[model samples]
Target: MNQPVSAVAGIGPRNEEVLATMGIYTVGDLLTYFPFRYENHEIQPLSEAEHQQRVTVQGTIHSMPELKFFKGKKSRLTIRILADGLLVKVVFFNQPYMKKQLILNDTVIISGTFDRHRLQITGAIVKPVEKIERGGLEPVYSIKGDLKQHQFRRFVEQVTDGFIHDIEEVLPESLMSRYQLMERKQAVYYLHFPKDEQAFNQARRRMAYEELLLFQLKMQWFRKNERQAGDGQSKSWDAEAVNAFIKRLPFELTTAQEQVLSDILSDLSSIERMNRLLQGDVGSGKTVVAAIAFYANFLAGFQGALMVPTEILAEQHAASLRELFAELKVNIAHLSGSSKVKEKREVLEMLASGEVDLIIGTHALIQEGVNFSNLGLVITDEQHRFGVAQRRTLKQKGLRPDVLFMTATPIPRTLAISAFGDMDVSTIDQLPAGRKPIKTHWGKRNMLQRVLAFVDKEIEKGHQVYVITPLIEESEALEVQNAIELHRTLTEALPHRRCGLMHGRLQHQEKEQAMADFQSNAIQLLVSTTVVEVGVNVPNATVMVIYDADRFGLAQLHQLRGRVGRGADQSHCILLADPKTEVGKERMSIMTETTDGFELSQRDLEMRGPGEFFGVRQSGMPKFKVADLLEDYRILETARNDAAKIIQSGALFEHDSYRSLLMMLESDIAFQEEKVD
Candidate 1:
């Protein structure tokens, strides 16, 4: 099964290179490359077919196939076929060679879109009835570059026939009996060429279960190994002192906040190192909860470090922490890439000397010169923004310090389990007291004047506004507004208001200055891209206007909306978009209907699958070929439970039943480690 593609029959160097482009390097890859969908060859009458419906029609050629040569090498072949006493025109593009095969009066099966209004069939696949297997399903694969569907299908068929029996089973016999699953080899073969719908369903169920089970086992194994690597320091702190500090806060803590804080403190005092994810919506008092955790870490005689994504966010967090810890006398330091050299050096010295109890910074905290005398806790804000290696680098600065990750982007529960199953999760489901929900409105481009008038009114009331554009600069491809052009236009439209522009293309200092100007109310309107989507809080910024709002996902739209409604006063989010699709319109409607991040996240996951929900690359989510995190959540839950039981029973390494599973897990771990390196 592990043999290279060159070992296969009829596959030469050229075909091998093409297969490599599709990630089919080994025979095993070829066998397991399941088709996305299957097309049934069951014939249907033309009279029963709806317009633009995909159907298979068996017809006799009624006219000679006309082949016409077009621009450069392009060609088209057209023919007339009679099915159910109805004559339909069949068209094939870029397939002039098919004219010779399609003979007049020959019975052929054509499968593609059937347009009833035009009496036309756009033929995707056409084969003579005598040569084609009737009442069978044809697999459709996603291929690229020079490899046609027939060629790829032949490759998979050949591999399956030759190596199907070589596929080893990972599930134990007990599980196989309990679940009534077919053999792995049979399932793999059936997935490529199923005899019936039931066969295909069984194959899919077996394969999906195996993939999910292996993924869960890998997560459980890694967690077990991490816990066994070293003993966590049992940090002790005064609970009454922490309570007193929380009581001293200017605002009361929500019940959700208190619960999450309690979870963090409980983890801190345990001998097991804490690896937790704290999720909350924007302006849900997560920062305050983090402050309490830092205070607890300080009381335990261990320094804590907070790492954020941007300098602007780091500074904001620093200011908030300073005010929150004022009476406690805890020394806090702020560091960033643009910090003055002398100040940075002094901060580093104080950190290494154990003088700074808490430090908040951007990626600068993980730099070479940064060190800590007793770093016991590390908190990364907007955790998804940082890569695994970046987080690991900061954690490596200390001796297995407890790690806490915070993200304002609330992921759905299904994704949370699949992506962060290795760590514990705590959610702040409630917002702080007296915080009014942001009012959202959808507007068309024709209503720009009205939206601008609303912005002007908000500015007159001494509040700032955020004008979000989808692009940084104008492009011929997209007709939406760009940040630079929008900034110029807004500045011209409202001459009395000051407009500041910020985007990813700007220098760190320039972006910082823009944010500072906006924070200081020097800029009444800020026209920016999605750079300000996370952790840029300004209570006076009461209005958010997003142009081309349909271009963004639901989660991102929710995050942008969260920028407003940070203060007690009522806020508004104006979505200026003329959506062309139902999905886009639904997204705008959902944004206007609710401000709950988790609900929007779930809807977003349902709309755009898990791979795109958090961006597969940075999300640390497993890329399962068969199982879907959203659709197969119940299977995932079962797999998780089964894996936990297997690990707890201490039979994974000791019993023969789990030998193959263990080997597969170890190989996956090695591959992951290689990727990280």
Candidate 2:
């Protein structure tokens, strides 16, 4: 099964190159390249066909096929066929050679769109009566350049017929019997060429289960290895002191916050290193929880590190933490890329000298010169914004310090399991007290004047406004407002109000200044792109106007809406979009209906599959051949449980039943690389 494409009979050197372009280098790759969809080619009478519907009909040719040339190399072949006592005109383009094969009075099978008004059938494929595989489903693959579906299908058949037995089973026989799954070899063959619907369904289920189960096993193994890496620091802190600190806070902790804090405290006290993900919606008091955790770590004589994505956010966190820890007399320091050389050196000296009990910074925390004197915990805010390498580097600064990841993005349970299954997840589903839900409304282009009037009114009330656009500059392809143009227009519309423009194209310092100006209320309106989608808190910013809101996903829109409604006063989010599709319209409607980020995330996952839900690159999710994270969520849960049981039994490597699975895991390049990392 690992043989190259050149080893196949029909695939030559040219075809081998073509297959390589499609990422099919080996016989195994070709076999696992499953079809995206299937076409039912069961013979149906023309009388049962509907207009513009794809149908397969068998007919006798009533007239000679006429071939005509047009526009240089282009050609068209037209023929009339009689089926079910009806004469239908069949047309094929760019395939004039069909004139010779389509004989008169001969029965042929035609499959394409049926046009009832014109009594015509635009045939995409036609085969002779004897050559047609009647009453069977035809596999339709996504092909690349110079690769025809029939040719690829022939190659797959050759490999399946010749080497199906070589496909080893990854799951044990016990699992197969328990799940009523078919043999791996039989499933692979049936997936390529199924005899019936039942066979296809069974084949799909078996393959999907295998993929999901293998993924879960790898995740479980990684988690086990992580737990056994080294003994974690059994840090101890006075519970009464922590309670006193929590009581000293200006605001009370929500029940959800308290539960999550308890979970974190339990992990911190354990010998096993804590690798946890703390996720919640925007303005859910996550920062306060992190502050409390840092305080406890300080009580244990261990330093804590907080990493954020942006300098402004780091500064904001530093300021908030300083105020929270004022009464405790804990030494806190701030660092960033923009810090002066002398200032950075002093901060580094303090961090390495055990003077700074807690440090908050941007990517500068992971730089080479940064060192910690007994770093006990590492917390990264907006965790997804940082790459895996960055996170790993920071964690390595200490001797296996406990790592905590915080994100304002509320990931659905399915995604959380699939992406971060190795780590424990604690979610803060509740917001702080007295927080009001932001009022959302969809606005059309014609309502721009009214929206601007509302923005003016908000500014008059001493409240700031955020005007968001999808692009930084005018895009020729997209007919939506850009940051520059929107800034100009807003400045012109409100001459008395100060407006600031911010986008990704700006320098770090420039962006920082923009955010500072906005936070300081020096800018009454800020016209920006999605750069403001993350952690930028300003209580005075009460109105968020997003133009072309449909261009963003539901989760993103929810995040942007969260920018407002951070204060006790009622806030509003106006979605100015005229989406053309029903899905886009539904997204706007969903935004207006609820403010729950998790609910929107689930709906977003349902609308866009998992691959596109979090963006495949940033998601760090494995690409599955047959398993779907959303559609096969139940199978995923089952696989996770079974994998956990196998691992907990402590016989994975010792049991002969798991030998094949172990070999497969070893061969997985991504899994091996992760193990090394």
Candidate 3:
């Protein structure tokens, strides 16, 4: 398993590079590159084939396959076959060699979608009965680069053939026995080359459960150890003073906010250092909550530091924090990597002198030159945006300062417990008053013209629009919509309106400038990616058209929708998705049904799963190879229960029985490097 993938049979340097693009570098990686779906190749007579289904059909060549190429189109191989006394047409794109393999009266089996357009099959896998070596379920790996499905399956089979036994059993015998799970070697063997559907399912269960259990154990262990020796100072609070400060806020607090504030204040006064997450939907009053905590820390003679993921957000937070603490005469400074030399130096100097009562900044706050006299409170805006390593670095600035994490990403309670097992959580389920529900609609990409027309109409009304694409630019390996192309398309289609583009690939100043232009109504339309998923708030923008919405997770789609509806004006979130799969269509339907983010989050967890729910583009989230928080909820919960007991007894890692499991978790890059308390 430790052997490089290049060491496997038929894998040269070029092949290694292709596989590497798919996350397969070592033989171990190849072994664990699980298939996302499978295809059954048991051929059926043409008469028995279901229309539009992925069906395999065998028949004799009824007509010659003529090679044809359009002037500006791809070459195609078109032919006809007679099966079960019925004629079916088949077409293959840019595959002229298929004609040589399939000739008149030659029996062939073609596996592909049975297109009813002309009673034909498009993009087929052709195989002569004599050349058929492997049959039954064939794994379709999640592949990238130029690796074809069959090629990847062959590589996995080759890797598994002579080295599956190298996969040592990490789970204890007692646990495996209790769960009736297959051994590590056996599970992997059947996973790649499953004997039957039932066996494949059993193999999947074992691997998924094992992965979830290992992660749960790691997180649970960290939670217990941190709480025991966690850093935080015990503070004495003046309730009368705290209540008076709350009374002075511009708006009254929601009941939910009041409850969360009480909980946070209690944690501040506790002996243990606070590590808590504050969950609220967008427009929820989380800012005031953070302000109250900082005030308490400031009254206790300690400086507060707030870290945001983006510079714009940092500046926004600094401005708001200054306004909130103005009555108390608290000094505030904003520091960021993009800050000018003079500004940065001045802020650092003030921080070191304790002249700044509170400092709000991006990662610049964690730099070596920025030192705090008494950093007693650490607050991270959009906590998920920062790496665990980065967040941990901030803690070093203070002696276990009270930590509060603010997030607009609404996660289901089940996920919050597992993902943030190390920290306590408080949720503000209510949104502020006058928050209007955004109207959502779903349509296919064929409706792009209508969507564009609507954008034009909205612009004429003096309202701005946001156009989102899943990708920043075209990728050879992916076919999702890209922002740059969409921006150009919009500019040409609208002709008169000013259109702008923003994505993660742009320079920081470019992104900031684009967002600023959009906010000022200088740009009628802004095409972007999920980089605008959080942070940018433009109440003037009332319409959002998300291209390829089916490609995004439900939680992410919800976040994008939240960008609009920030203003009192009627807002619309139009999802342009032509999903071919049932799951994708279901997601679009759900989006149009309700605007409840938490409901969408739970459904997202159930449909797209944790890793995907968190998203492939998002950072600082734990990745799991097998365990899915959605499909494996039962097993995940069971694993969590066991992990709790194991941690409570304090024998999960140190005990001889779990040594191998601990070793596996420690070596896994999926779980972030756990820093010992």
Residue 156, model 3: Cα distance from true site in angstroms: 3.4
lDDT of each: 0.88, 0.89, 0.83
Best by lDDT: 2
Clashing pairs in 2: none
User: In model 1, which runs have C-alpha deviations exceeding 4 angstroms?
Assistant: 44-52, 66-95, 114-124, 130-135, 228-230, 670-677
Candidate 1's error at 498, in angstroms? 2.6
Candidate 1 per-residue lDDT over residues 1-677, each given as its tens digit: 78999888878999999889988999988898889998887777778888899989898999998888988999888999898898989999998888888888889889889888889989657977874542377788989888888888878878877888899998899989998998999998888888888898899889999998888777776566556534677798888998899888888989999899989988888888888999999889888888888899999999999999988889889998898887777999999999999999999999999999999999999999999999999999989888787988998899889889999999898988777777789999999989998999999978989999989998999999999999999999989899999888888999998999999999988998999999999998999999998888899999999999999999899889999998878999999999999999999999989988989999999999998887877777777777888878998998998988888788888999989988887786533551221
Backbone clashes under 3 angstroms, per model:
0, 0, 1
Candidate 2 C-alpha lDDT tens digits along 1-677: 78898988989989998889889999999999988888888788778788899988888999988889999889889999998889989999999878888888999889889999998988658878776552468888888989898899888888887888898888888999999999998898878777789999999999999999888888888778668734688889898999999998888999999999999998888888999999999889899999889888889889999999887788888888888877777998999988999999999999999999999999999999899999999999988778777888999999889889999889999989888888899999999999998999999967989999999999999999999999999989989889998898888999999999999989988998999999999999999999888878899999999999999999899989989998878899999999999999999999999999889999998999887876776567778888898889999999999988898787677899989988887897767754322
Q: Where is model 2 more than 4 Å wrong at Cα?
A: 47-52, 66-77, 93-101, 115-119, 673-677
Give me candidate 1's TM-score against the actual structure.
0.94
lDDT of 2 at 8: 89
Worst 10 residues of 3 by lDDT: 668-677
- Ten contiguous residues with the weakest lDDT in model 2: 668-677
Which of candidates 1 and 3 reaches a greater TM-score? 1
